[model samples]
Target: MGPSTIPAAVDAAAERFGDTEAVVDGEVRLTYRDLRTRVRQVAAAFAAAGLKTGDRVAICAPNTWHWVVAALGASYAGGILVPLNTRFTAAEMQDVISRSDAAALVVATDFLGRNRLAELEELGGVPEFVLTIEDWAFTDEVDAAPVRADDISDILFTSGTTGRSKGAMSAHRQALAVAAAWADCGAVVTGDRYLVINPFFHSFGYKAGILVCLLTGATLVPQAVFDVARTIELVEQERITILPGPPTIYQTLLAQPGCDTLRLAVTGAAPVPVTLAERMQKRFGTVLTAYGLTEAVVATMCRPDDDAETVSHTSGRATADFEVKIADTGEILLRGPNVMIGYLDDAAATAEAIDADGWLHTGDVGVLDERGYLTITDRLKDMYVSGGFNVYPAEVEQALARLDGVTESAVIGIPDDRMGEVGKAFVVSTRLLSTEDVIEHCRVLLANFKVPRQVEFRAALPRNASGKVLKVVLRKESP
Candidate 1:
């Protein structure tokens, strides 16, 4: 048979890996058999509650077994699952719920308590049906449902690194393609246990972390939050074979007291600074970088067998099923089954993002090296013209991040009458540093035009739930 949909994977695992542990929390453990049963029951319940095909169902919660079960249930019931970031403000939360026209919301009682639900209900546009994780489980009756490959599976909203948020609509076939690509690239096999630190709310988290577990019969160990010490404990205890996280996560875990038992570690979300990969390899023996987004799922990932230089320097070779190229203007364009259909309810963005040739304009500046490795230079939106020269913020930010006493940095174009626009920097640091410090650092590695004209200190740069720096917010408040 061809590849199965997300629900079909649950069915196959239910029989093949029945008694094996599929999900594990600190004190809670569930076998595949039980997990599948819960998913079916939840699907039945959601169906009985008037959820229909193509309806949008939103889930706002942290990493937990319930998140996986609810998401799969929605997929099985032929509804579009919308995973909302838990860190969103009340306004942000309402905005997404309204924009997506979600018909129902499945939230965790602990995460989106009664007060938040009341607040969300008060918002004029939300769908009437709302159920907490606890309530959904306790329901007395539910009905059965099924899904097809082309059915819409999820709507993942991403606030462009510089623009307003847009929901990327992913179908079941596309979601399944991600799992297939990940397995082929990483050589993932049945029985491999993946530690899931990234939240399931993200497309990367759902497709790479949870769906991989379902398709490959791998076990999933879920964590509520990223605690370096706790992750080490789980890794050693669970003997987690595959780990996908950002460089910051790996860095923190490498610093943890007992981080020796991991077999494979994949880092992404932000650039994996060269030095960070070296430290991880020296400490844990397995370190690789992954590059992906909410729109295209996982387009590229470094293999575990790759050398430190490859892991540190490149985002990794493009996925086997995907095509990557540098547009004339340096933007990264992708063509593959992994690319989402389009942004939901936003025709303008859909037209702007995809062209007649079917390539999804990723809008991230990148270079395809002679070896076929892809190195992301910066966000196309984040690239600014300084004195008529194109300046990439990632290059300047990386240089500044490497400076002594600099914790994090962001570069943006600020108005300048003489030069038209010039680079300005916002820094988060503890030690005293000046604009000269950042300017000198960039001078050593970058052109004079790319260096920051001014540097300002802040306690910490504004970041979204996924820990991505919000340059959009930064530019708004710049002096």
Candidate 2:
């Protein structure tokens, strides 16, 4: 029988995989049975605190067993979960909580030496009753609330590069569908020790990272922060089988000495170079590439059986239960059960995102090859016309990635007196490189219009919590 809700899915998994280890965070470990019991206790506590069905519960914390339990428990108690990015400032978190109208907040008292709870309290406008992760205790048995597949399960806020963050509402079916699709595509299986380095606030980590593990009976090893040394130690000590993150994650792991070989490596959130994919595949037994947005998690993924070239260059075929089509304008459109319900309280934005025909107008540009693999070129907003030639920054960035000594690169369009707009490249390099050198390197690979007119070197590129380069920030910083 198909699972009706997220709670139901976890409950069924617990019954089937009773004694199997489900979650591991530092010294804490819990079996599937133990996880279910804790979830029920938390659910009971939430209900007793006067939270009702459909109430929103905001959780602002790092990746921890408490975050997992709070997410599951919020759903079990019939409340919708809103995971706030821990990297957000006090004002940003408060804005999300206020916008979400969260009835209660579960936040970490301290993380990375910053007292988030104290900040939230000082910021005011926070929900009255704030609960810390450590305060959670097992409570009396409570029945899981009855919920339909189409009921809203969570409202994930977008990264908000341009304006205020919009909450993407997702249904129970959508969440479960994406988790199952990721598991099927990534070959996630029982006993696989999945190291979740991606933050739980992001859909990739919460749905594909946490939910997938629960569905497939995989053991979850939660890494709150992405420290190279700690990650290497965990991979070796725990014998982690699955490691998924952005391209930079694999690059860092490869650079770290004594890093254990990975059984499976999944990379996304940014462009993956062919060289990086080939290297990861040679190092790790299997390397997979995937593409998805907050609206629909795991839309496309490269299969384990796919050749290195396919895994490296393309985002693979559309996932099962989803349909992908490139619009005439080259924008990637998706239609599937996994598409989010809508944007919370934003009718105009919701209408603009999903059309009457039921396709989510993904603001990304991509192409489908003869083999049906998809190559993401750039975001629609990031595309610029230079001297009547359309230049996709991602294409230029990919060429920059091939340059020796260049660790990472981000490209943006800046005003040009002659051309309408010209490309500007921000590079993080291992060695000092002159602008002339970068321009010369790009001229060899990219067209004249696509080549960066100016190059600036930085120690590191600005990135969000998910490791996606903040191109908007680069654009603002450009002269």
Best by lDDT: 2
In candidate 2, what are the lDDT values of residues 246-354, reduced to their tens digit? 6766787888665564789987655567888888877787888888878887788888888878987899998948899999999999998788888999898889889
Stretches of candidate 2 exceeding 4 Å from the true structure:
159-162, 255-261, 383-479
Go through the candidates in order and give each one's C-alpha lDDT. Answer: 0.77, 0.84
Error of 1 at 227 (Å): 1.8
Model 1 score (lDDT): 0.77
* RMSD of every prediction: 10.5, 10.6
TM-score against truth, every candidate: 0.78, 0.80
lDDT of 1 at 251: 67
Per-residue lDDT for 123-186 in model 1, tens only? 6555678878666554442433567788788899876543356899888888988877887677
Tell me which residue pairs clash in candidate 1: none
Worst 10 residues of 2 by lDDT: 157-166
